[model samples]
Target: MTINTTHNCTEPQSNWIFVGVYSMVFMVGLILNLTALVVFFCYTKLWSHTTVYMINLAIADLLLVLTLPLRIYYHLGMHGLSQVLCEGVGLVLLVNMYGSIFLLTCMCFDRCVAVCFPMSCRVREGRKKAPLVCLGVWGLTIGASLPIYISKRSKASKEIQVDRCFGSFPVYATQTTAVASTLTVGFGIPLVVMLVCSWALIHAITRSAVAQTDLINSGKIQRMIATSLVIFLACFLPYHGTLALLYVHREAVPCSLLSVYHYSLMVACLNAILDPLAYYFTTETFRRKVDMDAMTRMFPLNSQNSEGNNSRAPVNT
Candidate 1:
C-alpha cells in the first residue's frame, strides 16, 4: 500500500518545451472554447443535438484549461502553494479530463444512432428521455470524480523529504478507486456503448447506401467517425491501460511500466490538440456554419462574381 514518490520530469528541454507548448495551447483553447460557450448560450434556440453535445464538450475543455495555470505554476517551480491547493487543481483537472472523454463517447453514440436510424432519431427527438440521458451523463461524471476530492490528503514524508497531497489510501483507496471508476465510468461502459452504436451506424449506413445508392454519398461522414474512433483508441486506450496496470501492480511494477506510463501520459495530452480537428470535420453543421466566413476570408463574393462567366459556371463542374 506504500506509494513511492517520483520526481516530475525536470529535464530542461522537456520542462521548457512542455511549458511553452501547453501555454500556447491554453491560450488558444481558452479563446476557442469561450467562443463555443458564446455560441452555445447566445444561440441556444439555433442549437440541435450536435450543438448540445459540443457545448458540453467545450465547457469541459474550458474547465480543464482553467486549471492549467495552477499546473503551469507547479511545473514552473511554484511548489510553495499548500498541498490542498495542489490536490484541488488536480481533482478538477482529472474530472474534466474524464468527463470530456465520456462526453465525447456519448456524442459518438448519439451520432451513431442518428445516422443509423434517422426515423428513430426523430421519434425520440421530443421525448423527455433524451434530455434525461444527457443529465445522467453529467451526474455520472461528477459521481465518478468525487473520489478525488473525498479521499485526497496531504502527508508529510520524512523518507522522501517532501510534504505532498496523495490519495488517502494507496491500497484500497485512491489508486484503486481511480482505476475502478475510470474503467467503469470512463472506459468500460462508454467504450462498449460507443462500439455498439458505431457498429450499428456503420452497418446501417452501408446497407442503406447500397440499397438506395444515392442517399448518403458523403465519405466524409464515415471518415470522420472512423478517424474519431482511431484517435480515441490510440490516445486514450494506452493511457488508461497503463494506468490500470499501474493501479494493479503499483508497488512492484518494473521500470518499463513507468516508461509506458510516461509515454501514454504524453499521448493523452495530444487529445486536446487533436480534438479541434475532430470537431471541425465530424459535424457538417459546423462546416456549413463557417463556410460563409471561410469564403469571405479566402475570396470575396463580389470578386468572384466580377470574374464574369466563370461565376455563372459551377466551380466544380
Candidate 2:
C-alpha cells in the first residue's frame, strides 16, 4: 500500500487552531471526567445499572483525553514519532469515540425502557445485564478499532526522514472500507437508534398523564436525550461527514475542505467536555454529590441561599 502523497499538504493555520482547541479540551475534559470517575467509584451509593454505563463512558473519555497531547505534538509539526505510537493513539481515539457513542445509545435505550415500561418485570431483569452489555460494547469497539493498526503498513521515507502512519494506507480499498464502516457503525446506526429512542421516550412521556414526579422525571430524560443528540450532531456528524467527503475525493480534496475536516475533528473532541453536563443533569447522585455551596462561593453572588437554590433545581435520576 502506498501513501497518498498528493494529499500531504500542511496548513499551519489549521494546525495551530487544532493545538489551541485540543489544549483547552484536554484541560477541561480531563478534570470533568476525572471528577466523574471519582464520584462513580468513591460514592458507592451511586452504583446502579445506569452508573455502569456512565463509568465506562467516563473511562473512555479519560483515555481519549490522555491521547490529546500526543496529537497536539503531532499537529505542531514535531516529527520522528514512531509509527506504532501514532497508530496506537489513533486506535485509542477511535475506540473511545465509538465507545462513547455506543454507551450513550445504550443510555438512551435504557431510559426509554424505564419510561415506557416503568413497572415491567422484564425491565428490572434486564438491568441486571447492564455490566455485560457494557463489556460487550468495549469488546466491540476494540475489535472495530484494531484495524487502524492492521490496515496500514508504515515506512520511513528517505526524503522526509520520518515514518508515516495512516498516511500510507491504500486509499481505494483499505481507506475506503474503513471510512464506510466508520460511517455506518460509528455514526449512522447509532444516530438512527438514538433518534428512535428519543422519539419513543418523548411520545411515552407526552402521551401519559402523570403526576409531578413523573413530569420531572420525563423532563430530565428529555434533557439527557437532547444533550446526547446535540453532541452527536455537533461533534460526530460534521467530522464524519467531512471524513467521508475526504475519503471519496482522496487527493482531489481541497486544502480548505481538509482544514474543515480537521476542525470538525476538534469539535468532536468537545464532546468529552460536554458529557459531564449530561451526567450532572441526568444523575441524581451526581447532582447531590456536587457542592452547591462551594459552587456559589466559587462564583460569588449577593445571595448565597438563592444561588444555591437556583443551582439545585430539580433534575431526574
* Candidate closest to the true structure, highest TM-score: 2
lDDT (Cα, tens digit) per residue for candidate 2, span 232-266: 78888988888887787675666666667657767
Per-candidate count of clashing residue pairs (backbone under 3 Å): 0, 0
Q: Per-model C-alpha lDDT, please?
A: 0.60, 0.72
Q: Mind giving the per-residue lDDT tens digits that candidate 1 earns over 1-317?
A: 22354433122322554466567667877876775565456423455665666777788878877876765665565547665566666667667777778778867777676666567756457432445666777787677666555644423322343333221212222266677877776878877887787677767766774645655664655676678888888878988888788776665654466556645654665566566667733455444333433334457754564343221111110
lDDT of 2: 0.72
Off by over 4 Å in 1: 1-14, 121-128, 152-161, 164-174, 210-215, 253-263, 291-317
Best by lDDT: 2
Q: Provide the lowest-lDDT 10-residue window in model 1.
A: 308-317
Reference-based TM-score of each model:
0.75, 0.81
True-vs-predicted CA distance for residue 87, candidate 1, Å = 1.4
